[model samples]
Target: MDFIQQKDLSCFNTLGLKSWAKNYISLCNETDLKGVLGLLKSGAPYFILGGGSNVVLSEQIDQIVVHNQLKGINLVQESASEWLVEAAAGEIWHDFVVYCIQQGWYGLENLALIPGTVGAAPVQNIGAYGVELKDRLDSVLAYDPLTQTERVFNNGQCCFAYRDSLFKHEEGKGLIITAVRFRLPKQWTPVLSYPDLQQYESLQPGLTAQAILEAVCDIRRRKLPDPKVTGNAGSFFKNPVIPAQQYWPLKQQFPDLVAYEQPNDCYKLAAGWMIDQCGWKGRQLGNAGVHARQALVIINTGKACAADITAIAKAIANDVMNKFGVLLEPEPVFVGAGY
Candidate 1:
């Protein structure tokens, strides 16, 4: 219920961009969540921030920033085939993944080590190692500020597809996610479809869920930079999925193009490889630079502003388009004005 004026959010976001909000509120529970109804009804502009992992904030935000701090974990149901678990929107996503593994519940191992909160998960439809949140999600509890009513969205209603869901579209806008319910399979299988995880099947005598979790965490740690040490928002762009008609011609042009076969005769071209080919990896434009180890990442070499990060990203996207004719889309949500 307590609101602070002109709050600095440099540390709140992983990118470490210097952003200031006219007002800020940290909602720790449902009681605190309802306390801001007056502000909502008063027609004040606002933004909901959770974990601040997948967002880009401008230097100055002309809105009230609500920080979701709600936290709890509960066992909702248990069946012969599945286990229904619910987690508060504000819980750290990585910790929740580890907790599920510890409880002997499986199915979310492939999604381990992803940054952000449970609320932000569905918004981005987070995925890794061939598994996505939609694969395990059952339902989501969200409060629609537009109507000031709560609704439960079933898996089908969520309309999940490649790093996206209903939460990103018009119908789900301004809706505050309260909690997420996951229907994890009791009978589990390790998802090692990705080339990196394929090696683990031979390395471990009997591949276990814990091993997969650890391996995923290790792979991410080795590949991506920790925002604590170097400011970053992880992968900067989504791999472009092109049709066969377009893929074959590009393949003929670039024999070394890194790509994988997708469903419906489509191909998912590796965005990192394309960026590297453009000679931007480990290169800096102003204070923003592409990570030397991972070309998909845009790092704030320290003291970089939103504009600096935006500059390098635009340069990289532009270069990729000119060379490959593929449009690269940024994965993270760019917030505020002048993005």
Candidate 2:
């Protein structure tokens, strides 16, 4: 294993926060993971890093950092109704979505342009445009460092909820995801229920998966900054899901409050809308600022550190909470103390 020491990770994470890993190991093959996992099991602290899209490092990391680099995408099976596609943990998520379209596979079009790796997808139950990862996930293959064994968790076993999964739970803390397999349906259906995609209905006459993918990409491009150009980890806060009864009274007060009804009579309120109402949108605090286009995003304007970003996010959350009774929770995982 080519383990490096004292590696700077400022560029690795999407937020571009200044951070350093005390010891770093890049695992390009499955075999490379055994040694790293063994070390972690034997009382060595470690953090498994994927595409570094959904994390914010507020301080230098003292543990060993294992960067998952395993790469592969293969068609596992095909039938009249479904296509089983498996991708390595390190495969770029958008690239994989594009590949599926090229292969004539559908069902992932609505999830296009989501940042992060296949491994990270299940961890966060990534969702966008009225679709979530758990909607098409077949199973997740992960390695349990404590047990020194590989475990395959089917969709139900993953315990997927809104922006959450078993991987984020206590029992899954020591597990390292190796790969993800998605079951795409052969019967294609357009998911234009979202208002943005609904506007593209005129193109629905002969719209293909590529067309939907392109439309979604265009929407994301307009709404979000390219992480390469502006440092950010996509949506900074998860949409707060409040009970329908509670949301009704709040809705009566704030007629412009954006929310969507869920299966269990709960309403997923727009965190961005509330933040914008709190006057955080397009506003800056030091080097970090809320995105002008989307209040859900907190951007690193220039020379923004992890502290700058977290402090601004907290202020926004606090403001929203005070204005409304709902507490806004951050979406990105914090990798350091007091963030």
Candidate 3:
């Protein structure tokens, strides 16, 4: 465990935003968690951080920042067709995916290049190219702060809904994720379901997990700005899922309202398309603006405060709601006072 005071948090977050944590502690293993929790119990507010990819710290944090750095990976079981792999919370998400691919495991290739940690993956149910983390997750090991006990939750117990999971819900609040377990397939069955991925397949049909991973990484690199360079999260808002009836009227009006029908009577609409049509794709407001290539992402050109970014996000959401009658919800967790 490493502890520091008045830490400069610029390097901790992927966005490279200039921020400070009053106190910061990095836990290298679960054994260090008790002392960290004791610090948190001292009555100061605390924030649990993983890879710092999916978060925006608007202001200097006055509370303790517990940087989850637990790391390890083990193959618990392997059969003729399947393997169960377990990863500690602090493992880098993309690295873990690459490791699985190197070991001949499939299912996580489509999610390659996503920034964050294994623990945070389950919280957001991270997905890409028609592949979601829930599809491969076996269970999650989390520590209940209130109970002071470690509990394991299965897939069904996670209550995954689109990009949401139990960790995002009220009941699962105050629980810190310690580790994640995944079931990977030995036999390759590539998922080329998304439009872009399918198009890639048309060019080269028999895509392996490695091929899919490379393609997804290339696509993401071209589409989303690297947070290290641009100081931005991958996507600012989630694609709005509206009722089918509501979607039909908008589709009739625009004729190109990109939508996908869900299992229920709902329709998922592309947030980027809406923002782009509203003429906000490359629009800049001060240091904050929509990414020129991807409208769903908001970037900090330089020295943009969290409030400035949040203001732009609100403006985009308002315009989309006014024009399409759909509300855009933020994908990243907003921390600090101003959010």
TM-scores for every candidate against the unseen true structure: 0.97, 0.97, 0.96
Kindly list the per-residue Cα lDDT of model 2 for residues 1-339, writing each as its tens digit: 769998999888998888999888998886788777777788677788988999987558987888888899999999889999999999999999999999899889888999889899999999888799999999999998878889999999999998898888788856789999999988888777788988865456778889989999999999999999999999999999989889999999999899988888999999989999999989999989988999899999978888898889889988988999898888888876556
Candidate 1's residue-wise lDDT over 179-269, tens digit each? 9999998878788888899865444757789989999988899999999999999899999999999999999999999999999999999
The lDDT-based order of candidates, best leading, equals 1, 2, 3
- Better structure of 2 and 3 per lDDT: 2
Candidate 1 clash total? Answer: 0
Q: Model 3: per-residue lDDT, tens digit, 1-339?
A: 689998888777776667898888888875689877666554556778999998888568886788898999999999998999999999999999999999888889999999999999999999999999999999999887556778999999999987899998777856778999999987768888789987764338555788888999989999999888898888889999999889889999999889888978999999999999999998898778888999998998888767777889899999999998899999988778544
True-structure lDDT of candidate 2: 0.89
In terms of lDDT, the poorest run of 10 residues in model 1 is 198-207
TM-score of 1: 0.97
Evaluate all candidate structures by whole-model CA lDDT and list the values in order.
Answer: 0.90, 0.89, 0.86
